[model samples]
Target: MEEQRPCLNKAEKGCEGPVEGRPSYAGTGTLIWRCTAHDNKAYEAAQETRTRYPDSSTPPGWFDPAAAGERWDDEY
Candidate 1:
């Protein structure tokens, strides 16, 4: 039997939130999983990176500020 791995986020509050899987854009059927909080953090980081590198393009699934407060779950 395969044992499921625990959430990677080690928050003191213990967030064992639902595991979310986002499709990889690498033309593969690989799905990456992360807790909700970490997912939000990842999206925020993407947004920041896009801002810092305005001329560069972010990969698919990155948070788009022009969407105006649209949460990331909608895209993923």
Candidate 2:
């Protein structure tokens, strides 16, 4: 199976999705990532996994210097 990318929404909380891309927030022109939205339960589960498996390799979706500040043209 193909390896999956982990989410990069590492604010006060974490997530379980790929970093779709950086796009300008509607109307504000502020650059933001188009992330996968998860429900409360999914969020909790992801947090648990991350905490329990702290030594895991970095996910593909995690931020990299090469892709920093780049825009994702398509997100859906």
Candidate 3:
């Protein structure tokens, strides 16, 4: 957490999916962030899950990071 300080980009509101939404890192264009709080233990915790936030689908044949870019076929 201490390492995140000095500059913490405000997370987008209503960022659904996952425990927390993904936040982009500074100077690291390739990597992103997934925020999750484990029992409010900012320092010590046994296990914490994370989910990467990617761009949502726009329409058909769109790559949705949320769906991992799966096609929208409602025939299932």
Instruction: Give a tens-digit lDDT track for model 3, residues 1-76.
Output: 5334211112333332234323232112222333333212311211111122233223334323342212223233
User: lDDT (CA) for every model shown?
Assistant: 0.49, 0.41, 0.27
**Predicted model with the maximum lDDT:** 1
lDDT of 1 at 49: 56
**Model 3 global lDDT (CA atoms, 0 to 1):** 0.27
Best by TM-score: 1
- TM-score of candidate 3 against the unseen true structure: 0.19
**Candidate 1 RMSD computed on C-alpha atoms after optimal superposition onto the true structure:** 9.9
Tell me the alpha-carbon RMSD of every candidate: 9.9, 14.3, 13.0
Over 1-76, each residue of candidate 1 has an lDDT whose tens digit, in order, gives: 8546444454423455776665422223445455676656655665675566655444445445433222333333
List clash counts for every candidate, in order.
0, 0, 1
Residue lDDT tens for model 2, 1-76? 7544443444525555555443332222444443455333333544654566565544335523222322322232
User: What is candidate 3's CA lDDT for residue 4?
Assistant: 44
